[model samples]
Target: MSQIPPPRRRRALGCGIAATAVALVGIVPTAIVFVLASAMDPNYGWLLFITLPIAVFFGSVALVLGVIGIAFALTDRGGYAWPIVGIALGAAQLIPAAALLTG
Candidate 1:
């Protein structure tokens, strides 16, 4: 018989999933906006100022959530797959945001 995961494990998994979704929600739109902005005239560059800050906010939230999810999973002996995925996605979002912010 398969045993059900504990509540903590389930919560951790949910957190991981949420983190990944948040990261994607931030990254994808910002990427599209950046691409469009780049293709357009320099006058549209102001769009980056708006989009980049939003992306950074979401990325930061995702990173924190992913870290929290990972910690919960580790402590509860929950499976690590989702949390790792969350961390990867969160990192992916952050990298571009960092580059945009610094560049």
Candidate 2:
């Protein structure tokens, strides 16, 4: 006799909440910093132009992740992948900014 497969587990998207919060909190600071940097150094400001989009994208992803996570959790389904995506996009935003500072 063939055995039946087990049901898939539903994981939570913890990163989603954190990412949304981070984005909400980070937006102003980032904008301010970007403006200041631009005022001080146009080249650095340009980096902000590039990095800001990533941050916004990630922030939006995070919001979506949070919503999807909640919805899936309520429906008893798995939908935690969004958090990972949020984190990835968030990091994408940070990478260039960090690199600018480091390099």
Candidate 3:
């Protein structure tokens, strides 16, 4: 019998996965900072300096990646699931950045 062909590879899939992972990774420090900021005094505000940059950087990159992934998805270059998740999560990741500035 003839062998079956391998599955087709999707474009932008890596971007979607990377965006989701970046967003998730950014959340840890953001959560930590949020919890600490809530529990402690402004004296601990110094911690924001450490995590804020990381959060912003990750969040921004994830948002960009998510957008690119969605573009590819729309063009039928890739599947839609991961890109949607990436967009949602990446937007959520930005909340900590906003909080960092406001708090």
**Ranking of all predicted structures according to TM-score, beginning with the best and ending with the worst:** 1, 3, 2
Candidate 1 lDDT trough over 10 residues, lowest sum: 5-14
lDDT by residue for model 1 (1-103), tens: 9998655547678889998888888888777776776786657767767777777788788888888888888888887777678778777767866776699
What tens-digit string does per-residue lDDT give for candidate 2 at 2-28? 999987655455545565565555465
TM-score of 3: 0.70
Q: CA lDDT of each candidate?
A: 0.78, 0.60, 0.80
Predicted candidate 3 versus true structure: per-residue lDDT over 23-102, tens digit per residue: 88877886887787789765666887787778778888888999998898778656888877888887886776687679
The residue pairs that clash in candidate 1, if any, are none
Please report how far candidate 3 places residue 101 from its true position, in Å: 5.9
Reference-based TM-score of each model = 0.73, 0.39, 0.70
Models, CA RMSD each? 3.7, 9.6, 3.4
| Candidate 2 Cα errors over 4 Å, as ranges | 1-8, 14-43, 77-103
